[model samples]
Target chain A: MKSLTKNDLTLLVAVAFLTLFAPFILNPFPEGSAMAQFNAGYPDLMQRFVIFGIFAIGFNILFGLTGYLSFGHAAFLGVGSYAAVWMFKLLSMNVIPAIILSVIVAGLFSLLIGFVSLRRSGIYFSILTLAFAQMMFALAYSVLTPITGGETGLQLALDDPRILGSSQTPEGNIPVPGLFGMEMRDSFDLELGSWVFTFNIGYYFCALVLIASFYLAIRIFRSPFGMMLRAVKSNQQRMNYTGLNTRPYTLAAFVISGMYAGLAGGLMASMDPLAGAERMQWTASGEVVLMTILGGAGTLIGPVLGAGFIKYFENIFSKINATILHEWFAFLPDGLEDFIVAILYPFIGKGWHLTLGILFMMVVIFLPGGLVEGGQRIRSWLQARKSKNGRPNGTTEPAE
Target chain B: MDAIILQILNGLDKGSAYALIALGLTLIFGTLGVVNFAHGALFMIGAFCAVTLSRILTLSHTVIDETKTDFLGNPLKVDVPYVHDIFGIAAGNAIIDWAVPLAILFAIPVMILVGVVMERGLIKHFYKRPHADQILVTFGLAIVLQEVIKYFYGANPIPTPAPAAFKGSFDFGAAIGFDPNLIIYPYWRIIYFLFATLIIGGVFAFLQFTTFGMVVRAGMADRETVGLLGINIDKRFTIMFGIAAAVAGLAGVMYTPINSPNYHMGMDFLVLSFVVVVVGGMGSLPGAVLAGFLLGVLESFASMREVIDIIPGINQIIIYLVAIIILLTRPRGLMGRKGVMED
Candidate 1:
């Protein structure tokens, strides 16, 4: 409820570290065991978790803090991605320069969009943002082909001038930019008995950046600036009557969030070495909104959890086929097995979206504050039962 | 001059689709005040209705001819539909040829039922929630609907052809004393334009002439006052939602020949239609249609080779760019009424 204490922060950091090194932690599991799937050690997905976490965290600063639900934040992310990719193509392969340039470009872009969109509050703001995002998407898909690469998307080639890194052979070899020859996919695998423990160097790099971003978010949340943003959310007219300009504060939040998106975009290109216009599509933007709301928008840990949950489901649900469903239902009677499979059929493959839709509706209908509020409700209910039995639980009610 | 006229004609056909879709969107938003993101999906289902009808009409049973071995030295097989015998060749051919037109009859009830179910089951509950919640739920519903269609139809564009009579181009240039090739436009596209005009006109006339429509319009202006007059405004609005869905569905059904139906086709148009609504001024019905046509025409113009060479992706973004300019300058849109979401 209260701001996290130093000890609490330390404990959270330790848990995060453990989660990052989960493959090593799960080294006790036999090779190809079902438990091995639980390992959050893959570089590609781990980078996604952190990158999207950054995105959702930035979004929360605006929507979670100010109660402004933006339907078009993906525009900024796309802008950031394009800028980062441009940096990769034109300047150097070094991520530091690319990320810096991306943040600045995205920040400027957001500043312009936010300035116009923020003129209207509530639903109008949402529509305006959506309009701008769509405009950007359409432009990228068609007119901006020279820059955005249209539908097929922009890719790095062997001929791209790597001013800061060693050049690879121009014949069918394209290199992913790295920090001083440290490849993004480079990983160390340790064999422990029958299990394989993998530690990706890229994962650690992403984790370090995520930690720094998290710390920055914490500082922002705890700052006076955050209080003003909350005030704007609560009552902008009152804030205006109080002789305070709320525009700058809202714009600042928007810009900061945009920069965070840029950082995420830069990291994405660093890991994958490509940028596509599809990344900027309104749906991609909507995904982050879902992640933020699902995780418990406004809460620091909620977006991360939401990101992990969605990504995990995306992976697991896509892997499930009709055969897999049949195998799972093999224990039942022949008639019942087919019946159950039929019922479960719509929740797998392309039907995975049906599951997500039902889940989203359930969350919105029941858990408005998302998983964080759901967690708090459970904790309080348990505490209430304990107190009724004359055992006072030390945990207090959560702050809004 | 001929090229310009042809382009204008082309623009009119494209504009008609945008106008119809945006009109439906605005109707729901104006009256119910719920942004129906699934409207596009309803449009898609309408197209799929034509696809379904075509497939049904073509349904056949295969027969093997043991004596008719050919190139592969295997038995030749023939496929035949039961309808081929029952209806005979002429009637069967007519049915197959007219599948798309006949689909309009089937699409109406289906889309209206979908609309009613959507309104009563989901959107009815969301009346008091924030617009964000409405957007999210509707978005989720859209995804669910699209995915369901994709699951059944697979993720490919299914071509639904126009009727044989409407297959060729109309020679407008010859009628106007110009070269025959200069102003040729597809007969189907002309039919689409006429269809859209009729639907739009019929919708306006119904609202203006019928007592029920008048009451519904009154409710759109003020629901509480209409309710105080002892009318069931909610039921009327629900009906209005159905009408809106039907309109969108009709648009989708007619649009099949122009562009093949895909699982994600609705989404491609949804954003653009929303932009049309905004540019027309939010919650304004006429504004939506006007903006839709205007932007659609502008988009067509932007797609000209010379114009495209100058501005590149201008055609793709022309509508959105126009929307931004209109929103910034007019704020309430070209004909936006005061106090309608201005707050």
Candidate 2:
């Protein structure tokens, strides 16, 4: 704990601050305001931001540090969710056991997958993991219907035998997940003037876990183990010639990331109580990968930012309908407004994926280091301008 | 025995599609040394090309039908296709029916254009990048391409039927001395198999016999040497990219009859095709084809009633399971060459 550097501590504190105040921070617009549609302070989206943040952070530990991209990480996430839900159904409504079981199960699953997949490097590794995830998805969606609940998804049943707790609440509803006596869905709303801030028990609980995960990730980044991972990424052949077996290190990273995904999935189930097979699909895996890369893969805070950015935009963009577009563009002449709306329609609302895709490609092409690199570039450019004004062409390298 | 024969026959058309896509993937990987993930999008685009052509052929204007009245007693209006005015009713209807086949001609040029532009515009910049970057960039491009398709064509699957002549099933069991009606195979599937063979044979011949192909093959072996010999290998490789894209597009175009063309069909086939490539050997063209068909047949056999009764979900994981085993044991795949993507 004492090994934490000042920068790491500052970064941790910043993230902790951001997550704690997310309800207020996310809901900048007041209730019924014209811009209120853009507010993402709701419980569902906020829960997702932190949960997916955890997923991406863990992913970065493997991909960013070790440079091993696993396209099957979602399989672990799905397994985690299923395990948690099963724990809820079979044993109790208490979430601690479920979360622990999910992490452990996911870790084991990832270890098995990583052991085989780590045998190959590069694209082969990616494909192997993808194949495994897809196989898991296919099975969960079909033959494992009894266990997974097939396309309808695994949901808490009223008839479920709660070995440790009552099957149903006092109100006759299927008992919701909780920590001790506090239910996950319970929330407190703070109304200041016209604004409403939802302080949810689930979001706060998830936030604490995310902070712990982020702290652990930061520690990992600064540790010798992380340096070894970076070594594996830079050149595995050199590491081998240096007599260090790189496979174990990679497998460990894969498993750790898988556990993180599992943790996120567990949290997701704890909040929602429904585990769906769709969460394990290749596209879901791709979403995490996109989040990690889009945030800046190797950077500590990047994945969290990326996750928040994507989830927030996804919510905001989906809310932008034609009616909203008309309202926004009311100032323009009719024909021109229609023309602009037509031009912009496909990139917003249901077409947010198109925008995301374009943005992803642009980031990959121009800013390989992701938003982190963009920030660094802008800072450097500003510094370069300052130096140029003072020193008169004394800057050595060109600002890129 | 008939069931086995039927499954194998059923496997052939899908195997053909896999082989075609894998074949194109190998060509791009071998020639340009780029992992083209958007190759599946090219296939989807090809299927949509057939859909587009069919839609264009059937494009119509409303004409009044006084003989048929609506419930409200207004004259019923019937759509009269522009093709009917140009080529007469029977001919136009036939053209529309054969749109899936005629799309081969229509798609070839369009696909080649798309391929060339993709290579020249996007892939050209990625030549010196790492394989991961290539994959990521191509994947992003794929998403963009797929979403664009979804925008133009709604999310539903558009069924593009094969020509009426090839509509019915052929009694393969009866012809081959098995029980009659035991092995009824779709004519279009047989035609698809034949067409796939023709394309595969044509590709092999093009690479084997032609001077341009020879240079391209040499470039695949050693680009520096070919360039040193004053042959413009890059140009040939670019053309090879176009060829690969066209091949995938043609596969998609032909596959419309087997399965309806949806925006996501490419992504569905892509993961399997990638497995085919890895199992076949990354850069080995024949390996891709061999593995494609082998896995396809294997998949069918696994899906058999007896097999599923025993293994439960063997059919779902068979290809991936085989891929994992083969990848672990044979590392370079079935017929992979050394020094190709080994790093």
Candidate 3:
């Protein structure tokens, strides 16, 4: 294997640092402060950030690298969740066997769907994957009630057999998901005057897994296989004419992405211990697509950034209501404050989707390369300006 | 046998909706060469037009009728619709009863306008972009449209009943020498089927018979050659988009009475309709219509109690299952032509 470039190593280090201290970085405001409401360091939200980040990274391997816009990755994610939960029910509370089982099951399911869907390209592939996912969703919601738990979703019961460990904890409670005897839900809080920060075991576990997934993704992106996937995206016709079979390359990418989704799903189940049929829906698939595109599809950090951005927005926006808006606008005149709240009301709270939709449209229209590209453009422009300003004192050549 | 006939009737009614929506989808795809993900939103808007019209008709003002007393011994205020004042109470009530049919007239112009604006404003810019870009933008638009509808309608299904005249079910089995309630079908569903047929026929005839249609067909086949021939094909395509929108809108307007118009109703139909379009063969109009009915009937049949007893969960996923099989085997769908998104 080829060694990582200096740039690649630097990027990996930066990502590792950011993810390692996310609890501190994400919670910039003090707990008692007004700005604390904007903080996203809570265990649940933090878990989602890394989990969805993993999901998007996997999705990026397929869609960003291979240009296969699968609208059914959620099916694999849901399958992973179900598999993990079942593993817990059948085996033990340890997340290792459950996560491993999830990846294997989701990989198998994706292989089957990909083998069929990969025969077609473009819109047809999208539709095919979508159809398969919908079929899974329908079955989960209705017919596969025994395995999937129907509308209520699959949950652990006290009667489940755990050959490796006790079914019930020493405290006479249903055993929580954990590694060996170490519980996932246990958290320690650090307080400093008005500031408080929580360190959760489950969040750290998810963060480590996300870092591993991210490292694997970076390896895949830099590998020869990644180049072949990109080649498939660029020109399938040319590759075929060159006597190179693109199907296996694409199928591998699809399976890899599917496993990533399964891992994310497993982590989610390890956190919550439930898997709903809605997790397999097309809209959920669309959300992953949105996250990938919004951050920048082909770029390494884009999917993770997009996932974090969307999850953060979903959490923050949904928490704001009319009362919050009123409080925010209270400094204005009496009539004007009420008027401002009324006007701003619909775009927040339950209307967050509207704001999200409009933002998505604007991004697609104006920033096709997404927020990453926008950042690059801004950085380049600023560099250009700085170079022009220093041209008199130095060489007149343009900065690279 | 009667039960089978009833199921078939149910299938046809459902198929009519699928066929209608798919027809508009195909029209847009054929002429504009764009895959419209927001076409379902147009159907939703059409349904809301009826809801809006009925609301308008029943707009009322409070009148203090001292003859009536409240439970608190205060004079009761009676609200009388303005329509009741202009046209007597019975006539106004009758007019409100026929709000849905009246919505057809109201929806055509509004749907066309909406379609034209959507095409000119957003879709026009996306014509030369990649299909992925077009799909994403249209999907975004669909979400925006849905959220807007939800904001106005409060996310609940608002029931819009059929007129009193078409409220009852007709005993078709009795007329055909079977027991009286054996093959009974709703009068509105029959009307809807007939209406869909008329619109489908009208669209086909418009494309097949008219000179404008001939030009549009030529443009669909080869745009550069038609442009070389000095025709303003873009404007005509825009009109065709409006027509397609009207068709979808009319379908939604009629469908309101079948299932209540909800904000997410468009999304509910969107995936299924796309499946119908794909199974129908991408840009093939007749294929879209044929596959729509075919899949719709298959869906109804799969939902039968006996079928469910055997297959267990076939009812929920029959359409998608059929789609996957057809896509894998047929590839180009049931009636797809050469060189239309074949890659």
Candidates in order, interface RMSD in Å: 1.7, 0.9, 0.7
How would you encode candidate 1's per-residue C-alpha lDDT over A264-301 as one tens digit per residue?
88778777777887888789888998888888888877
Can you write out model 2's per-residue Cα lDDT over A195-295, one digit (the tens) per residue? 99999999999999999999999989998999999999998899999998988888889999999999999999999999999999999999999999999
lDDT of 2 by residue, B169-232 (tens): 9999999898889999999999999999999999999999999888888999999999999888
For model 2 chain A, give the 10-residue run with minimal summed lDDT. A391-400
lDDT of 1 by residue, B1-343 (tens): 8867877888888789889999999999988999888888888888898899889889998988797888999999988765687799789888888999999998899889989999999999989987878887788788888988988898999999999999999899998999877788899999999999999999999999999999988998999999999999999999999999999999999999999999999988887888888888888878888888888878888888888889777777777778777777788987788988775
The number of the candidate with the highest DockQ is 3
Question: Could you give the fnat of all candidates in order?
Answer: 0.63, 0.79, 0.87
Error of 2 at B146 (Å): 0.6
Q: Clash pairs of candidate 2? A: none
Better of 2 and 3 by DockQ: 3
Best by lDDT: 2
- DockQ score of the complex predicted as candidate 1: 0.57
Task: Give candidate 3 regions above 4 Å deviation.
Answer: A392-400, B66-75
Model 1 clash pairs are A143-B313
Each candidate's DockQ:
0.57, 0.83, 0.88
